[model samples]
Target: MLRAYQFRLYPNKEQQSYFANYFGSVRFIYNQMLADKIDHYKKTGKMLKNTPAQYKEEFLFLKDVDSLALANAQLNLEKAYKNFFREKSVGFPKFKTKHKSKASYTTNNQSGNIRIEDGKIKLPKIGFVTIKQHRDFDGVIKSCTISMNKAGKYFISILVEQETPEWLPAEHKIGIDLGLSDFAITTNDSDESVKYANPKCLDRSEKKIKKAQRALSRKQKRSKNQEKARLVLAKK
Candidate 1:
């Protein structure tokens, strides 16, 4: 089984600058690949064959960031293009914009180059960063994704692969149906059925949630109070 554990990161000023560069580099590589792939498809009805290595020569600053992050960006762009052609449900890959895109990058773990040591987690290029591991995980670490939220909070999501015992299939199958009226209804092979009531968590708090949001909307945009109110609404 593959599990993910997330921990809050407390990086110093220099580390924060490095993170900013990494995020920008990954975004740039992704956007560049997407654009080139689109143009390639238009010209030859095929995906582009560009790699991140080619960009390093032109954009020397890319060398400052984690190379694996840029490689992952290339892989992500390729997957997106593949999905667009192979699956009709998804649209063509879009260019990433620094302003609206998720500020994150991914790096792989090889020979334990990345790990938690001496109360800090090591990342490629950047040294150990202080991490708050609220919960402990004992699985083998596979990769890590570093992300920064809109509120400027940094987090590291560690993907871990663990071996789990295989489970035997149930002798009987159950059918499940969900609805707003009832949270869920289940029927077994014997035609026995049971219905679960809706928790009505939000339904019960609708008025309060609406009032808080209304108050939030009235606050000055981009103000500290507005930010706090936004957090309150999100919690609801």
Candidate 2:
């Protein structure tokens, strides 16, 4: 089994520029490959094959328009297309935005330097990137995926291969039914007292949300008042 880990990279101004260039190069490759597919299909009535060697050949032409960093970025584009065709994954490779989420581009892990030491990890184009170490894992890392959450936090998810034991105990088995009013009822104890976390907090929040929604409904769409009302509702 394969798993991925994501880690945050704190690049300086110069490194940021390098990252931007690499990102732009990968985006261009993705768009070009997409266009290439469309053009080939229109002429041959067939989808183009996605192979590493095939993409490597296409990347050779990028020499006229880009340098080694740009050429290296195409590796990710190739993997993207490979996954798209092989796994039937949605969302084909596309151009990236300036302020996009984490994972601007992916490249080969040639450096053999995945862990952060001295509060930093060395990166291509970018020098050592500062990172706060989270929980550590014990296993051979298979892949690393870097991403950003909605709250603007950078995370590194490290994928590793691990073996887990399966449990096959038949001594304790019970059927349970769950409902809105009652949480659950076990077959062994039909009349057992069900545990319930008081719903007073939930009811209070629901009432506040309802009030905010009603206020928002009264406001006209696209109006400043409507926007304010929307914020209130969202907060609720």
- Strongest candidate by TM-score: 1
Per-residue lDDT of 48 in model 2? 74
Q: Candidate 1 on 149-226: residue-level lDDT in tens?
A: 866789999999988859998999999999888999999999999999999677769977898889899999889999
Evaluated at residue 108, the lDDT of candidate 2 is 35
Q: What is the lDDT of residue 100 in candidate 1?
A: 78
- Tell me the spans in candidate 1 whose CA falls farther than 4 Å from its real position: 165-236
Q: Candidate 2: list runs displaced more than 4 Å.
A: 6-14, 46-103, 148-153, 163-236
- Model 2 Cα lDDT, one tens digit per residue, 58-93: 566444332343444556666776687677756666
- TM-score of model 2 (CA atoms): 0.52
What TM-score should be assigned to candidate 1? Answer: 0.75
